[model samples]
Target: MLEVEQKFLLADKTALLDQLAQLGATQETDQEQEDLYFTHPVRNFAETDEAFRIRRIGSENRVTYKGPKRNTVSKIRKEIELAFESGQSAFEQLTEMLELLGFHPLRSVRKRRTPFTCQHQQRAFEITIDEVEGLGLFAEIELLAEESELQEADNAIIELAAYLGMTHPIRTSYLGMLIEKETQSGSD
Candidate 1:
């Protein structure tokens, strides 16, 4: 699947909160997301850029690999099912691989909110973090899934962003940030 997401840097949380309430977009769930970013060698040990996701949004261990489409994913689903049956989740396998690669683990966390979905889904807000706190942070608001949809998710979110006084878009993915920090810290 093609994952297209937009993120923004919120300058005012209080204003955003009020706008969200006015739009009836209540916070769905807030939790700390922790994870480890590591590098490994797969395939020919020369080509693949292997990485491990050691933790996730709370304890919800959902490993999602975004492949193009059906046929490829169908085979993956089978393999994943087998892994679960063997009592070895994908994360467990990944953890083992990372250990073998001589990569030390780096852990981090950030608070995130899972957005609530409703009919037409005219408004939605999802804030997530892989490492909790002021660092490795990001926020998102998705609106209007299809062009034909009557309600616009963006209008509400944009209004909230303005109300919150958003100034810039945070382009760095938390995973990427954590990797940089972990490697830098490791070198030090």
Candidate 2:
């Protein structure tokens, strides 16, 4: 599936929440997520603009692969995710298996996320407000679509973002921002 998404750095959390409420969006349970990114043994994922990560939410574990962005506008990419067994033991086994195969853990991004969902123009969009550790707050509007529905999905995301008064959509991924920050800190 194609993941069409736009992210913004939130300047005012309350205002965004109020706008969401005005749109009749329903908020879902808050979740704490830890995504551990990995580096391939022979290839550079950063240069390739790809990502491989294992995300742990509570006892559930998911491995996700995000391909390069297909366009310059939004984060339109192909994503494939698979779920593993639910437990610490399963999580460890998966980690060990990856390590044995030469994948090295790069870093972990921790965030507290609250998700909201609403329908716009007969299409459903999932919006998330994330407070990333070390990085500030961000809001993302996302829609999963098939190849044929890319244009419609992109339009819906742009319209919803404008409705929320969110300008200057950030194209950088959370992992990329974290890495940039680390690079700057180390240089200083």
lDDT of each prediction vs. the true structure?
Answer: 0.44, 0.93
The local distance difference test score of model 2 is 0.93
lDDT of 1 by residue, 53-156 (tens): 44555545543332221121111111111112222365567667667877555444445554543222334444322223545334564433343332243345
Candidate 2 RMSD computed on C-alpha atoms after optimal superposition onto the true structure: 0.8
For each of the candidates, give the backbone clash count: 6, 0
**Cα displacement (Å) at residue 21, model 2:** 0.9
Question: Cα lDDT for residue 186, model 1?
Answer: 92
Q: Which stretches of candidate 2 lie over 4 Å from their true place?
A: none
- Which runs of model 1 end up more than 4 angstroms from their true locations? 42-54, 66-94, 97-131, 134-137, 143-164, 179-188
Clashing pairs in 2: none
Worst 10 residues of 1 by lDDT: 73-82
TM-scores, all candidates, are: 0.54, 0.98
78-184: candidate 2 lDDT, tens digit per residue = 99999999888988888899999999999999999999998878989999999999999999999999999999889889988998998689999999999999999
